[model samples]
Target: MQSPPATAPVAAPPERGTSPRRAAPRLVGWLAAAWLGPLLAYALGVAGVLPVVVLGLTAALLRGGRTLLDRLVLAGALLLGAACAAGLLFSAWPWGLHPVPVAGTALTVLLGVAAATGRRPRLPRPVPADLLPVAAALVAAGALAWPYLRAGDLAGRLAYAMTGEDNSRHLATVEGIRAVGGYLFADPSAAARIAPEGMVWYPQGFHLTAALLDGFLRSSTAPAGPASTLDHYLGWSLGAWGLLVLAVTWAANRLAGPRLDLPRAAALTGALTAACLGSELARFVVYGYPGESLGLAATVLLVALACRPVARTGTQLAVVGALCVAVGFAYLMFLPVVAVLVLAWLVRDRRRLRRRPAVLAVVALLTAVLAPLPAVAGLLRTDQVDNVATGGGVFPRYDAFLALAGLVAAGLFAGGLRLPVWRRYAGALAAALAFAGGFLVYFRALGTDPRYYYGKTLHLLLAVLLVGAGAVTLLLPAPGRAAQSRPRAARPHDRAAESRPRAARPHDRAAESRPRAARLRWRTPRPARALAAAAVVLACAGLAGLPRGTGIFAQPFDGRTMTWAAAWWSGTQARPGPAELAVRALAQAPAEAGVVTVVVSDRRREGYLATLFVATLQGTHGASGPAVYRLPLSEPARSAALVERVPGRIRFVAADPAAAGIVEALLAAHPDLAGRVTLQRLR
Candidate 1:
């Protein structure tokens, strides 16, 4: 974390509003990456989520010295990118080829190669600063997550969900991974049940991580049974939402520059929070799209990295290329957006990048090596893409307003162009323009309801706009200083100032005046200037509200969203339902009991969702009932008769009290299930 040695000794302190040499405040980066990295590795290891930790460490070995957030982001991208590529590579293997061993072997080779490069990973230990901004961002994100976390237990936490269809299909996809031992596509029989079209080329980035997390939970947690299955999906879904907010806040802070004061921290936190709450993207969680949520977070993080200066080294570019590949894995649709940012990064550093053609070639090579090529090619063939592209609907209600607001925000970025530090912000500016331009093109060329899929891009654009809001705090002088200090007359453009790096530019008192075109002279009151800056920050936050959705504020309101969780929770209701009975009975099973499949015989429709829950919990991969149908059959004796034929896989029969006795009697005479088959009766 040592700052590069000062080129020349300077008497004056660094300029207040200028960009920093490093992406983040030194102390904050140290706490985020250096201290947290080992703890994360240890936690993942104990939880049996080993592949992610191994892959992350491998990427870390390649290079380090970026800001704390930047380093962690690169590591995360590599972990996900490796899993994704490995999943696709071995995706066609037989059912017995488990994801763990396959992923472990692949990562081992990569780890060895990274080690052979002899580049030790070393994080920079930048100078210390208060962690106020980081702390504020965390607190704000926790508040946004109140709906999921407010519930006392896993079942209770899952009650806040809005859609069961997407949840079930996604959980089925996760279970599909566990069932086949690799990607779901390798076993179409298992994969076909998860999605209508069969998940042959569906992005597994979100599902890969979820499957790993579910494995950890399955290994560690006591048998809460079916409820635990729901817990895994719900937990990851909520986490994806929280991650989005935190990523945006981090980007905002990074863009605001290194030295953070109290006001700047507060501004960054407020602006990001308000912007997220007001945007349509906040609804991704309730809408049951955690994959898209996680994808967007990766998308934002990728852009943030592009905004920073990258050294012209093969290893660094390779790391960046892996990040691009990770974005595709997280969500394919956002890859185009990330591609634009990557191009901007190269364009901004064209001088250095052009000098080493081999480095650019290395980046392309690494990206291809890590990409899910077959899946990328499959994007065009999927009916889902066709529906999104050619589907019906007009432009979004707020499209025009958002477009104007985005342009207004671009003006803030425009002001940075005058400074030599503009290179650092060029990517963000390009992203905002990309979003606006993409929106227009989609509306004209694609489906009528372009908003259905393309609307999510607005969230990324909004994040960039809000970063501009946070940077305002860094640009304005403190009220205290403004009040006491008088601005000196405008001095001629100094050759010395032009020669120095943006961060090293000394705060010269004699030359402390606005540019020659100044309307506001140095004689203008400093307190008023400070107040004006604060107003601008507030104004930016308010502007975010211009594109507000109907449920903009409802997302964070506990009282309003808590009601949505009731249907998913099985405990303490006036009348215990079929799903409740099945989950409760499953919960009674011993933790040591090896995977047990139960045929659900609830006459009610609740059995459909309960079947998915049971399928996930039993590790049967959607093959749980005596006969797999959309809903469980009501006749227990008939199901028992079918179970008698397949005693090897069907371990238990969950039936209502009225039919449990008949089923139990039918199974009693069977030699294979004489004592093995247990009837879980729901009265």
Candidate 2:
């Protein structure tokens, strides 16, 4: 079962490259193997969205005719992309149009079409060796997730044990989508009276998918949690992130190539996993950036899809495009990473790439480039420029880590010049430039947010390590017919052995002692390669623990951090967090369904719940955005027209003067409701 080594001047025999006819079987096999871990982990987490991912992969297989590895990586990308795209499309519909049922319906239609095409792929039989890599990834993923999978319901882990303001906000978004049936582009709470005129198009891949999964789990026959919102948030986090470990391992496999014997592949897998499980990922989890984390993993798979040999078919190109769209939907901020890889791959095969997949690559780049402009990037919703701080700090604390990584990446590029797989390092070089450029230009122009660059460079660092692994695998000699099959002609001295003097004889001991030009550098031995792989894993594993343990920031997760974690939506409000308070406040609102406005002037950000989801959640109307949480209702008419839009019986949920001002504004706006407005205080 030995195959040709990936490196060296040896070319694979014509028969070795699997033809299009064999593609269907391999494609099916690859998809099964690649998705095995994710399927097992997310079996129930996202049953609703699963068919969408599967159907998308099926569509990609229909476009077949690639090697097993290519099909495997490409299928993963297509599956992820399909699910996200479906979620985005459905999220645009009304609340009744939940992504789960909508995507399921679409999947059914796509599958029927696929069946009719007669190009249906068969799942390939995976060998024991193939299962090893899958096991490795799943194991690594389980290790990283050990802390989160504690004994208890998800709400306990997420509510009291969780940290960060984003997760709750993400939950709010998911609930909002679930409530609205689609991304109405307005606040989710605007269902009551009138949501603001602002049309939101935020990518709903992560949020919508999570919502679908949460709904699936809730309706399941398992024990129920205390509240459905926490369950939904937990489902979203796991649905997007549960497969991260497998995704990274698959990317490492793509970078290493299938020609690797089990040992080398295993070694590369370790190094790749080490590089991938960085501290930033932990921070993303703890900090609550589900979208960013999901994007990071998706883009890794995207790179694997894009880095294929030219001769790519239209179907393959379509799969790549779908994956790219998903990556965009998940985290437009990291779109450039995938775009750059596609461009780099195209440049490498200037001959074939120029004709094939070139249009696909261009379209991908255009999608990424146009995402920032409000005119066409509306699909991104709140991720637009309006979401960024117009003014704030310049350099985030992580800049130091990014800079250090840049230098190391540069040194790697410089030092690994002679390796056969040096070209693979293009990903690293491009990512480095992108990272530096974003820091110097984009963040500076848009104001620095800690979360902006935090998850961006994780893939970049892993990319650098994968490139290094490629170089090692290529430079190291592999004993195969292709690698050493070609025998060199006899040397001149050997042909004229009888004519040589006694001292010049080939067998002379002095000849062995003499220096020779061919021995300039010692070829990296197999043991050394194994050692290097081990070292890479150890270092990366140590760093991987950094964010969760004592990271570069060394910021201990003190009581304040716990408060932030438990705070979820409320940062540092009252005991149970602001989301709890806001939900409680809304629960107390008049059940008659009048406009019930909730306000939080402090950093709690709890008020967005009122503006976003409280309306749909509580069966009332909420007409305030998070910004208005701090808005002083000094001018009655202005305040009334601005936030407190209810004509009568405005339910005020803040104790500050701003809350008072809103009541005054409500009274002034609707003179008939002078005594209807009421205030409630939360302890």
Candidate 3:
């Protein structure tokens, strides 16, 4: 029999430390670093030092003698520390501030420890080729799972776009780019008119993309009224979304390598994608919610770049770090998270720190380069401060307790593997308590309807659980080395080697025969198990309640009335005709003629038709100097009185061609102004 391929050599354990294993100091220090770090950073504006303190403590506990695992941990820590320092510097530096004193102090201690123990370590091996296929499968699974996971949010976004109410602002942005040749920043006046008055709260990156598309589309088309192209908008939105997914998948694959098997990778990617698509972050990309996604993506990429091998030069590292910090300025949530994650890395990877001083320097340079623009913008704009403060109303103070508890639970569960089963159970119980406490605190603090908060909490919890489950599943034990090398079937000699007594031979035979029966029993139960699963799924579906009607599934193109109107407009190559002409004629009329009254069938002055009329008049003749009044012909006497108020000016009555006959009847009843009024079709 062949021996199992020699198991990859496990790294030798580090030598035992002489110091007593006292839990109190270590636990207290960890809690302080985790809880107090952010507060200190916020207050002092020096965020990089806390992580160094944490790293020093961790190193002291772990460093009796170096092992390969210790070295790897040290490398990871250095990378993290460097990222934190870089982010803080970049975030604050543009204001002409330096975080260098804090960073320098941290670094001096780290280097001193490294110099005393003086040992250089090599980088880990490149990702294995065999793992590529597993990564591809994982990414594919995530993409496939995305739509199902995000059905509700996707449906809502589509509905919002189809309504053509607030959507017009999105359309106008696209149109303005085509017509005026610049984004909103370039032509503030034009943009201000087209965009909703308070839309600055929305993220600018997605809208900026829309503007770019408009410019591209406009080069081919003539000057038009509004951008009504649905296909174009959908294509651009989805394309950007697809790119985000691809980028995240690539990053995950790079970070985790073959250790992240297909199923685990898929679960992680799917959860992340679902979170992005369904959370407030998606609102940033979809409804132009504003800078959150840009900041998040930037922060993640910066960490990834910082974690890259040290063969790269300081200039290259600085460029990557700068971009990260620049993008982070777009949203504030990323800053603290980025800081914590990086600090965590630094504590975990000390040895790498000594070898790559240049990494720290590059991070500092990048942070210096990228942090100022937003800080300056924030200082100049009081409204920005008000908006940020208003958003804080949703953040409940108690949620911090919950978050802290959850973090502690996760850490304990991960590190407590060597404990007894009851201890493991206790760790799990602690985690659950933390989660519950956090969830309830957040729920009450947000002050929204409980149902809505519950939904949000459910989604957040699901994402957390999915990631946790995936990580655990991926790390579960595989076959032991000896078992892996064994033959599929037992030989007679193997049975003889057991040296069983003759009397026990029959029992052995009976046990051997039982294996077949067990196999058969397993096969027999599968169908029942499947049926039970199907029944449970059906019951859950029934409890959830299905949405009623074709309306739920309806797409934008399903609105036949709107489709017909669009088709007619496109088919006619229609220029605005009589209504527009009448507006121009009225504007050109002498001041004594008074305001022109253009009577249309609708009561609402800002319906789709009314908006079109207003846009056309503006496009053709600039807002007609004489106010054009819209009087609804549905009320004939009132319409007549309004027309009489503007007697000498052209009294143009326009109605949908289909509604003209009804209008004519009303006109026939009113003889006094009938001769003066001109009826026109608005087909």
Which candidate leads the pack in lDDT? 1
Residues 145-193, candidate 3: write the lDDT tens digits. Answer: 3332343432222333332233334444444433443333334455443
Off by over 4 Å in 1: 1-66, 89-117, 126-141, 153-155, 162-164, 187-197, 213-224, 258-262, 369-377, 389-414, 419-451, 478-682
**Candidates, ranked, TM-score:** 1, 2, 3
Please give, for residues 550-613, the per-residue lDDT of candidate 2 as tens digits: 3232332334332112222222332234445455554455345444465543333345433334
lDDT by residue (1-683, candidate 1, tens digit) is 44342221111222233234552464345434433443454456543555455545654454432344445555666566666666665556552334344434554465445334533334433222224334534654454456556665545444444233466567667666655556655556655433323445677678777765555545432224455566667777767777677667766655544323334455556656655655555556555777887777777666656664333244446656766776777677677677777777777667767767976886777676555453455666566566455433434435534554555355445454444334455546566668756776877774344555555666556555555554454344422432223222111112234345645542322223544334223344646544654765566545544223222222223333311122222122212244454455456642223334554553644444444455555555444433344322455444554564444544444555545555666676566666556565544
Candidate 2, residue 161: Cα displacement in angstroms equals 7.8
**lDDT for model 3, on a 0 to 1 scale?**
0.37
Q: What are the lDDT scores of the predictions, listed in order?
A: 0.52, 0.48, 0.37
Better of 1 and 3 by lDDT: 1
The TM-score of predicted model 1 comes to 0.65
Q: TM-score, each model?
A: 0.65, 0.63, 0.42
What range of 10 consecutive residues in model 3 has the weakest lDDT sum?
Answer: 546-555
Q: Where does candidate 1 clash, by residue pair?
A: 1-124, 1-125, 1-126, 99-181, 159-565, 160-565, 393-448
Which is better, 1 or 2, measured by TM-score? 1
Model 1 Cα shift for residue 490 (angstroms): 29
